[model samples]
Target: MDLDAYVAAHAFEWQRLEALTKKRRLTGAEADELVERYQQVATHLSVVRTSAPDPSLVAHLSSLLSRARNRAAGGRTGTWRGVQLFFTDRFPAALYRLRWWWITTLVVNVVVTGVMIWWLLDHPLVEQSLLSPAEVDQLVNHDFEDYYSEYAASHFAAQVWVNNAWVAALCLALGILGFPIVYLLFTNMANVAILGSIMIRHDHGAHFWGLLLPHGLLELTAVFVAAGVGLKLFWSWVEPGELTRSQSIAREGRTAGTVALGLVAVLFVSGVIEAFVTPSGLPTWARVGIGILAEAVFFAYVFVLGRQAFHRGQTGDVDASLLEDRVATQA
Candidate 1:
């Protein structure tokens, strides 16, 4: 397709459009020229995309066209509609689209935790090396339960929210590096497995399950979601398929950002349950039931709303009209 020759033929028009777009003010003639140059470059972009499809050139043209369009339209600001669309469409679609990643993460972690607990239980020496008899007794009888009730419920909820949010944020932020997410998730599950093994060994299995299930179900699920999204970000660049690494990473990064924002609310709900429901005077059945219900509702939201948004062609990236068109087909 002689991509170089086509780019050379149209470079001047693109440069002229860029210059006009950056101008502080435009006379009527210059304004008309800006619009003319915009249209010409837009055509050049279309032809280049159809005939040559060079990644770098297409990205450059797309950026230039976006700026020109915005400059021509006088730019726009954020609005309530955008926020509403993010929750109702973008966020859910992202979760739904990436459901398998997180669901698989959840399953794998669960199995790992189960195996870890079983192994720990089989080796009393392992528990003894980690914690002395007094420490184990303190944890099994009082410390574990006391940890939840030591602080006021509201204060504890806030603390839990912040801590979990930070972990989730770390997953999304360090996801590009890949191994950090694995390390973080492993350490997390190891802690749970350690505590469960210790308590169950001391004939406190009922007490442990009662306290953990009410909040752990939804809380851990949120963590799994974050880890899953983070790994997906890592995979985007690793196996970008037809996309250039930058394009794939950029698209997934935006979707990851949406998931990060949505997880804040999810963690808050789990935090509230951890502080209030987990430590409340309610019986084991009710507390566990509340936790189960929250987890069920969360999955329903993802599968129902997210699936609808995905089917409607929402990929959780920012509006397509404002970005480069990467494919001929919608979504």
Candidate 2:
């Protein structure tokens, strides 16, 4: 395709475009010249990409064209449309892409939690080590039920919201560390297991389920999803496949950040339920029904809307315009 010669022929025009774009001030004629050269270079880049696929040449021309277009057009302002697009496309697609990771975490943690509960119940020594007979009696009889009603609903909701959000944020922010994600998730399972064991041991298992199922369904799912995303981020760089390690990390990091933001809303829902419904005197079945309903809606949001977004090729990553397409890389 004689790519070198083609580039050489248009080299002066390209140089002029670059110079005009770089200038802090430009004459009217120079501005017009920048637009004209930008168009010509766009055509050149297209020909180079089709006839001679050189990553270096294509990247260089792309960068020049991008700069020229920006100078010719000017900056775009943010709008409500950006927020709309985020929810409609990016956020859902990102979750759908990582569905398997989150689902696996959900299953594994649930199984581990059950096993821990059984282990604690079967071994008197384990339960004894955790809490003395008197303490266990108090926890199962009073503390477990009283914990929810201990604080006013409004105050409790805020506290739960912040605490759950912080835990989710920690899972997401420390996901790159790999082991931290595992540790964080394990700690969550242990807490649930300890409580479940104490309740079952005291023959208040129904009471435990009645209280836990309401908010626990959605709340725990949100936490699981956060931890899954974090572990996925760690795996991204560990096994990036075709992408360079840096590119893999950057892409996953951006997507993970979006997920963390999305979880804030999910956790908010869980928090509201925990404060109002969990502690409220709504019948146990009704509270569990509402929790299950909320959990169902979340899954539907991810599976239905998220699947649509993913199939349409939206990955919840930032707009292509925002990513530096000119990052030098070998083809």
Candidates' TM-scores? 0.78, 0.78
Give residue 108's lDDT in candidate 2 (0 to 100): 99
Return the TM-score for candidate 2, rounded to 2 decimals. 0.78
Q: Report the Cα RMSD per candidate.
A: 6.8, 6.4
Over 1-331, each residue of candidate 1 has an lDDT whose tens digit, in order, gives 7988877877789889999999987788887887678767777777777787889988898889888878765532155766677788988999999999999999999999999999999999999899999999999989999999999999999999999999999999999999999999999999999999999999999999999999999999989999999999999999999999999999999889989999999999999999999999999999999999999999898999999999999987777545653333211
lDDT computed for candidate 1: 0.89
| Model 2 Cα lDDT, one tens digit per residue, 1-331 | 7878887888998888889889987788887787678767777777777789899988898988888766665522145766676777788899999999999999999999999999988987888887888998889889988999999999999999999999999999999999998998899899999889888878899999999999999999999999999999999999998999999999999999889888888999999999999989899899999999999999999999999999999887776645543422321
RMSD versus native structure for model 2: 6.4
> What C-alpha lDDT do the candidate models reach, one value each?
0.89, 0.87
> lDDT, candidate 2, residue 255?
96
